[model samples]
Target: MGLFTAIRDVLSGFKSLLIGMRITGREAAKPILTVQYPRETLKMPARFRGHIQLILDPETGKPRCTACTLCEKACPSECIDLDGLRREGDKKKSVSKYMLDFTKCSLCGSCVEVCPSDAIEFSKQYNVVSLGREQFAQMDLYAKVEAEAQAWAAAHPTPPAPPTPATPQPAVTPAASIAPKAS
Candidate 1:
């Protein structure tokens, strides 16, 4: 009876090992999903989130941020540091400096949602790599937005209006002066 029990245990172990080997064999026969990295890049979907950037106004060709501080307040990690300058005789504050600390940022997208002017959006920079800690500290998001606006303006320039032809006009004769009657 003891010899028969030992034989059954050995057979069960062999069966489990065979099942594992079978799974490994099946997986090895399939195509590899690993990317070659530098040579081959993966296409990210539209909903993929990366870094944060400022949204620019199409008409003005500038950032739509009014420096309302709504986004700064909404950031849970306190990674957003925003600054604004109120020019002389200006009613509203204009964003002068906008910094984003990616080190502490959790990519929560909270800042983008609370923006009233719709000034914040995610950038499609998926390959951001930093070797040093200081490199990931803060990024000048405002400058990047400004550069984008300038580039867009350069690419799509408004055509100048055609000059109108100058035409000679006849002058109207003055009416004869009449004496005013006493009421």
Candidate 2:
């Protein structure tokens, strides 16, 4: 009876192994989902949040950030450092420096949501890497935004205002055309 039980246990283990092998073979027949890393890259979805970037105003050709520091306040990781300089007699402040620490950032979109001016949004730059720890540790997004704004301005110059048409005058003045009534 003991020998028979041992033989049965060995047969059960073999059956389980065969079942696993069959499943694996079936799955192996399907096309591979993996793509070549560098030579062939996969496109990210539209909503993929790679990082934060600033929007620049076309009219002023500058960053749209009011530097309210709302984004900084909203960031959970405290990765955002936004600073602005107030002019002597100005009510609004212009962004002086803007930095982001991507290592700590969770890309939760909290900062983007809290921004009142719609100044910042998630960037499409998904391929971010650093050669060393110091490199790309703290990125100044404001400078990149300014440079892009300038480039856009140069590329898309506002067309010159249409030349004003000369105002038309009556071919003949009423008094001049109307002969003095013969008295």
Candidate 3:
């Protein structure tokens, strides 16, 4: 009786293995779930977070970013960095250095969600192949900003000189205050 039971258990295990193999074989023949590179790429949604891309103000052509640094705070990876340009008054600061180390990015999209000025976003560009470490930390994001700063300065002329203030006038005492009231 024990020998017969052992034989039956072996047969049942083989049967179960065959069933699993059949399902795997069927799945392999079905349509693939991955996108083809350099060919049939899937269209990404408006907010499909991928590579980190700068958020630009369409009107200013510049960063449109007010250097609020909200995106930096939200970044989990801390790959994004921004330098606030120095300004005297109303003029905006030029970006001294705007960098995003792509290697460290986690593709979490936390930075994009917190951007108040819509100055941080993700791009559809997936091919970021790099050989060296420096290449991985590409500084591609700053090029557009540099050109915009130049163009903004050229198009928007400087304001005219601030008008001088007039000379001070003596304070005149009214007659009612100087003369005593009559009985």
Candidate 4:
């Protein structure tokens, strides 16, 4: 009885090994699906959420953010902080300092959605690497894009100035004109 049992166990183990090898052989015959990461990069999907950045106005070549604080208020993680100053002739307050604490940010898109001017959008920068935590702690969004904005502004023509009102002509009275005719 013991000899029969040992033979049965050996046969079962052999069968399992053969099954595993068969599966491995079949898989090995298929084409390789591994990506050579360094040589070949995969395109990120359109909906991939990355860090948020301020959108520059094409016409003005300036950040669209009005420094309204709506985005700051809307941020759930409290990662956004910014201020603005109303220039002497400007109607809306321009962004003076826009800071983003990326460490605290959850990339929730609240800031982008609450912005009234469509000022902010998700950046396509997927590969974010830093040596220290402080490196990503306080990212100045305004300063980062300042040079690009300046270059854009320099390249583009300024908007046409508003048409000035013409000088008013002297009012002519009907009686004064008739007297002048001297019939």
Which candidate comes out best when scored by TM-score? 4
Query: Per-residue lDDT of 134-158 in model 3, one digit per residue for the tens?
Result: 9657556767566766787688877
lDDT of 4 by residue, 86-175 (tens): 988889998989999999999989898889999999988888889999978999999976777989978987879999989989977788
Q: What TM-score fits each model?
A: 0.73, 0.70, 0.55, 0.74
Q: How much lDDT does each candidate structure score? A: 0.89, 0.88, 0.75, 0.90
Candidate 3 stretches greater than 4 Å from native: 1-36, 87-90, 138-140, 147-183
Candidate that would win on lDDT: 4
Writing each residue's lDDT as its tens digit, candidate 1 over 13-95 gives 99999999999999999999999999999998899899899988888687889999999999999999999988787677879
Instruction: Give the Cα-based TM-score of candidate 3 against the true structure.
Output: 0.55
Q: Write the per-residue lDDT of candidate 2 for residues 44-91, one digit (tens) a residue.
A: 889989889999886667788989999999999999998998867757
Candidate 2 matches the true fold with a TM-score of 0.70
> Model 4: which ten-residue window has the lowest total lDDT?
174-183
